[model samples]
Target: MTETLPETAERLTVNTAPNWRYMLQEYDELYRYLPAGGSDKIAGHQRRVREAIARLLKRNADVRLQPRAVKPVTAHLRRALDEGRTASLAPAVRALDAVAEDLSWQYGYEKVPKGLSQNYAYAELAGTRGPVVAEDIILGVVLFAPGCTYPAHAHKGITESYVILSGAVSENHAGVYVPGSMIYNPPEHLHRITVGKSEPALLAYAWMGERENLHEQKMVFTRTRK
Candidate 1:
């Protein structure tokens, strides 16, 4: 479960300048893959994220970035990055991985099934949390350990998008998604993710919509596959 971060428009601070810069650089690196055809919904969602980041960059850089204490989930990120050395991954994924250790990360779905908690985590670049530039929008990276299954969940008043950075994940038990694949879920879209058995998965995500929509962004957990 995401924490209830109090909203404050104060110029945010980071632990260091370079780490913040690298994270912002990922916005451009990721925008290059916005799909041109097929589903207009996805194409439009990608465009919105790109534009939002563009606006974020125009704001004054009030950041302080530092290496956060490594969490257990980070181990899987490290392992997946090591595996990606030989696998085909987007250059943006590689760049983000190089600085993965510097971002602060947290677990989602507090009531998740036993053991699943340690298998997944996310790092926020902007939100109610620090480095917050835009309101009602969230940009971050999420990771799951190999063989981990992020349980079924639904969001209230939120539109979320994810760009798969590395490894593979099965969404809704169907399509096998790989690097650069984009997934968009409208409010209340019920979905779960299962990582490939041998490699972990890393995904860059953006969420926007209602609730106070920041501190109150509600991501409700449902059942898990048994």
Candidate 2:
């Protein structure tokens, strides 16, 4: 039986440390799937991912974690998980369960290109959120509903990487990235993503660099969906 979304979020209290532990543990699990060739591309990302998590763990869980309204696109989360693209990601999938329902899933407004109907919900687990996990680096999950297209955008002084947990995504002019694909973008590199229409796409993205310069990133949408 499919587990329904829980309405009552388990009160995290000030004991969100365990939750953070699970989150980091999930990121660490990515190391288990490295290619035998030892691609330096992925290796570098793994290191940064760990470093970001480490920095986040040092902060205080001062703010209360609240459950936000679930957007209609979140309904596809289960479909993405059930697709079973990568079993090694089971733990990561399970981790989302603990917090997915509470996510403030919403459409990109100011950042989206003109007239594009893309909806995304991201939990900046570390830094950028209420509690502020880390300042220089960020850890978060991005959900793109099927048929949604994330317009081209770029960041300044921030290097970004996206680890596909399930479904598929195409970074404009870069080609399609499926399960287990590690797509990275440097600061000021303009890129866009389109999700498969039949199922939703979920990506665990990391941002490393100057946190103060993050605002320098903005959407630059030039295409319209036909």
Candidate 3:
């Protein structure tokens, strides 16, 4: 049986759950900015994002996850603000930003290595501890160093969207997306991203579906010689 703790003299409990209502508020905002009929050709991607969120809620059914874990979701939702889906995802992005601002907490960054002296900052949204709300959005940020190649990869059960904020990054999806551009990845679409020029490249990314449960098949880089 689960042990129950007594309340403090001040009437406060030790195991208070995180503010899920607030989380939902942000989610509502994000939904407003997303594209309509996002699930039409991109149903799988949306499923993955939702699945990841479901897993998080299941794990942290009581208390809130640490601030660092939840912070990435805001960025992920923000990235969904590209053409076609911008109208539906706008409110959600605003809500997420508000939550981040209210919490006054942010997650740390890590490096995704591409090659020697080339790397990108990655923020994980679906780990042991993260924000738990709806099961529809996997959020994160990618920061690319100048001239860095992110290599080709494929989304498993979700579609991905990237919004460029700073510098220049090239995305090879369908063809190529230049700086100040946005790229959308349909489920299982193979692609790569590389930074351009001397400045750093920053982007917000949102993947729709259950990333943790789904297995992403890695695409071989045939152009690269071993």
lDDT winner: 1
* Residues 1-226, model 1: lDDT tens digits: 9899889765443324555656666765675565745877777776777776666666644554434855577878776666655555456666676666567877655565787777888888777654544565788888888889887887787788887778899988979988767777888899999999888888888887753755686556786557
Question: 110 in model 3: Cα distance from truth in Å?
Answer: 14
What tens digits encode model 2's per-residue C-alpha lDDT throughout 98-215?
6655555544346544434436656665555533334566667787777777776777677888888888888884688877777878778788888887778888877777666653
Instruction: List runs of model 1 lying over 4 Å from the truth.
Output: 1-16, 64-67, 84-89, 224-226
* Greater-lDDT candidate between 1 and 2: 1
Q: Give the TM-score of candidate 3.
A: 0.49
Candidate 3, which ten residues in sequence have the lowest lDDT sum? 10-19
- Kindly report the root-mean-square deviation of model 1 from the true structure over all alpha carbons: 7.8
Best first by lDDT, ranked: 1, 2, 3
Query: What order do you get sorting by TM-score, best first?
Result: 1, 2, 3
Query: lDDT, candidate 2, residue 80?
Result: 70
Quantify all predictions' global Cα lDDT against the true fold.
0.72, 0.65, 0.47
Greater-TM-score candidate between 1 and 3: 1
